[model samples]
Target: MKTKLFFFIFSLFFFLKSNAQCAMCRAVLENEEGQSAAKGINDGIIYLMSIPYILVFGLGFFVYWKYFRKKKVEA
Candidate 1:
């Protein structure tokens, strides 16, 4: 079980470096006339990448507040 979990984690790290680009997109972006489009593409990728992390953090904070925060007892 430990080995399987280790391998799964290792594979995830390997896949993290992979990009979402394809051959056609790469060609067009590389040969484009202006830099604005490439900048837009990079910004879009970053925007999309951040959404999941923001959602997870919000969920974690909610959970902590609901279950872990200390409650005051009524006198």
Candidate 2:
């Protein structure tokens, strides 16, 4: 229960601060000129994040397929 509460508060803090900004932060993010750059950077971040998961899943899938095929052939 205590752990749960601590985790909840920790997560809440991060969520609240995730979009943390000052005036310049808001202006830059919202500005037309900065939007493309911001979006491109965000996209790169997403791509970087997604690569590891995609690679892991791809590897797991290949292993699963190989094992299943081998089992069928053995049977």
Candidate 3:
């Protein structure tokens, strides 16, 4: 069933791609619309992608400073 659905969509994509005439038809068929909300959504995607790396590195620094440093005495 899953394979059938995948093949169906794959064939549809190739059929449409092969038949695309120009930018307008491609955009229409692909359902891409020019919208301000799309820019906001794109920004949201970038923020989500960056946040995990920032968090992991930030926590790594915090742990290293808080727990890994040796105590020193005046000599």
Top-TM-score structure, candidate number: 2
Window of ten residues with lowest summed lDDT in model 2: 14-23
**Residue ranges of candidate 3 with Cα displaced over 4 Å:** 1-34, 71-75
> What's the TM-score of each model vs. the native?
0.55, 0.55, 0.42
The sequence of per-residue lDDT tens digits that candidate 2 reaches over residues 35-54 is 77666655566557657867
User: What's the lDDT for candidate 1?
Assistant: 0.72
Which candidate has the highest lDDT of all?
Answer: 1
- What is residue 66's positional error in candidate 3, in angstroms? 2.6
Of 1 and 2, the candidate ahead on TM-score is 2
Q: For residues 1-75, what per-residue lDDT tens digits would candidate 1 score against the true structure?
A: 999889967966765555555577767897988867876776677568768967997998898786655553322
lDDT of 3 at 23: 58
Pairs that collide in candidate 3 are none
Worst 10-residue stretch by lDDT in candidate 1?
66-75
TM-score ranking from best candidate downward:
2, 1, 3
Residue 65 of model 1: what lDDT? 83
Candidate 3 per-residue lDDT over residues 1-75, each given as its tens digit? 999889967975664434323455445545656655444555555556657867987998898776656433322
